[model samples]
Target chain A: MTDTQNSRDAVVIERTFDAPVVLIWRMWTEPEFLKEWYGPDGASIPIANMDVRVGGIRRVCMEMPSPNGPMQMWFTGEYREVVEHQRLVYTESVSAESGPVLSPTSPGTAGGHPMMTEVRVELEAVGNRTKMVMTHAGVPSDSPGAAGWAMALDKLAANIATNRGR
Target chain B: MTTAIDEDRLTETFAALANSTRRAILARLAEGGATVNELAEPFTLTLPAISKHIKVLERAGLVVRGQRAQYRPCVLDATPLEAVSTWADRYRPVWEARFDRMDDYLRQLRRQEGASEADD
Candidate 1:
């Protein structure tokens, strides 16, 4: 059931790098390389423990500045499949520093469990370059989960009747 | 970056929006401010139950009740909705930046390789 939900709410991103497939794969699998560019600008990965093999666990912490203070978010995932430079798949869960997964009720808050999602990275060699297609599956857009709020809001936006009652 | 207060509000807003009856009431109110009875007309729920839903929406800042009139019609306030949309879109720029950084790193790697080959 969750698998179907994830496929339905997946968000995909594709990028082509002017580098070989081997180098691109390293950027994803190696903690040293991943820490350099895993998150957005101004966000730092303070802790990155990546065991790239299948069934290995990958734990990372992304810290960024917030209005209140410095905010840290922990993500833990297990690699479901690893196909060298060709493909990689994993399941991700957002958790707290102590390691228990958070709930989705309080998004962006410390210790709030955002929905778990699967990520698939497919790398194809294109001459000297590499084409990477990243599919973040099961984003919970409308499932009985965190994304349900966003979906309901969308429905409300669409169903709003502009006709004012006099 | 999102603050804890903002996150709390978002959570409240989502919780308020989770119910189908409340969503229907909000849709009705979006058309125009309606009294509790008017909002309850479409659903099989009792007037008090609809009022309870309105209270939740009001707490979440999604709905506002007029004070000047006796009926106090519930009005839809879309400010929280806008916040929800912004939160949803927050990940896009992050991923874009990550990709751009990766591109830059790849260029640097190629440069080093080219320099090393020339030295050899």
Candidate 2:
């Protein structure tokens, strides 16, 4: 079945790959494999620090060539659910290179997307092939305003943690 | 990267929308403009309570009340909603592109495995 049904608020993509389920899972969980195929065309992932467990941290930075210059994008998330090769759920957020986690309620970067969003991935083995379903719910994570908002929130989080210790 | 979307205004718009009462009010307003009393008629909520909802919508630029007129009606501006619509569909394509790259990489991996098996 094709990934033909999806709504605007949440995006769902389904694909079948020739690789076995274990290798597909490794491609996602392992940073080395992830760097080889994560990001848009012509974009390079210089950083892919993934701890691939429940409550583990995931930090990724992707760099792309632009008319003005090469731009780097940073994002961080925590793995909320990890069911080995079958499923994974994580909360993705635009983050600073310093890697401060922003609250879901925190304002987003440009385009008015949510500061934090959730991504769910499910994998199934079909004979020797792997079927993967990925769902990303919330605003698309991009826009140049991310750096400013991330830095401001980084300081805000520091000061707030200083006071609340949360 | 950065476009013209205002971060604060967008936050305010969502915050303004984060209430059931306000959402109901918007749904009611969508039919047409209504006076404060008329808008309050559907709910058991008091006039002031409904008025507070209207104020929030008004502040978010979703509702515009007529001024200098005896019969002021709350009008739905819909511009912010329009802004929301403009950016809503962007997330899907980004992931689609990455998945395209993934498909290519998976093919390459299969090729390498086939090569190694041949060597053996």
Candidate 3:
């Protein structure tokens, strides 16, 4: 689907920071700085390996507390494009510690993999401040993968409505 | 940790949701529980086909079929869908925190730069 159509599925976040583009870029590309703020609340990043060149590999691990105790989620990706202080594009996938885990049905492919997505980050310098627009694509929208979810949610609303006698 | 198992279930849930007809059946169930015949009313598919769709939803833990007398009503179980929604939203807070930290780090760096410039 086109980006416009896929917008419904994608998560687009735009923020302006009172920092130069160079500094903002470092926060994203430098592992030490990235680890400080790259995870959800209550999660920590113990390992972040980032190779800022094109075709370089990036591996990050985010550990969070689960009901069963601590759990680590590994994400591995490759840098498809890296423009200094301006833009970065990567294809990321959830994986095990060893490496990318092949799906049982598709031995060599990660397509249709729910945990896989493409991230595009664009940084623009506005005077000394920086404006960043991050688009997380590959979130299945009305496609077969997510078609049921949209409809199921609608049905759920309907069920709730009927039960409330409204 | 059962993380692998949870991931597998998430995959199954996505796969089960990948069909329009199955989604329609689920929408029907959301109105209330219904037998195979009642669920299949909106679709042109056969009873067996509807049953098959219900089975997929059941396997994904999105639906539960009640065993009542002659009517086996399929009820919508939104727990799994809620999980899916939560997963989708997992990154928002992550990036927000990262940006906040970046702001602090940048302010510190600028202050150091100013101090060194004055010393020079």
DockQ of each: 0.32, 0.15, 0.37
What's the true lDDT of residue A101 in model 2?
39
What CAPRI-style quality would you assign to candidate 1? Answer: acceptable
- Which residue runs of candidate 3 sit more than 4 Å off their true CA positions? A1-12, A39-46, A51-56, A62-72, A78-86, A91-114, A135-165, B1-9, B88-90
Stretch of 10 with least lDDT, candidate 3 chain B: B1-10
Q: Candidate 3 on B1-120: residue-level lDDT in tens?
A: 224455556666766776878767766666777788888888888888888888989998988978797787888887876666555466556556667776777788789999999999
> A26-88 in candidate 3: lDDT tens per residue?
888998888766776788899898988888878789888879787787777778799999999
- Candidate 2 residues B56-75, lDDT tens each? 99998989999848768887
Score residue B108 of candidate 1 by CA lDDT.
Answer: 83
**Weakest ten-residue segment in model 1 chain B by summed lDDT:** B1-10
The per-residue C-alpha lDDT of model 1 at residue B80 equals 82
> In model 2 chain B, where is the ten-residue run with the lowest total lDDT?
B1-10
Candidate 1: tens digits of C-alpha lDDT, residues A77-162: 77889999999997665643434444323223334434455678899999989999887643331235554544666667766523
Q: lDDT score, residue A161, model 3?
A: 57
Q: TM-score rank, highest first? A: 2, 3, 1
Error of 3 at A103 (Å): 8.6
TM-score of chain B of 3: 0.77
- Tens-digit lDDT track for model 2 on A17-73? 887889889888998898877877788898888888887888788888879787677
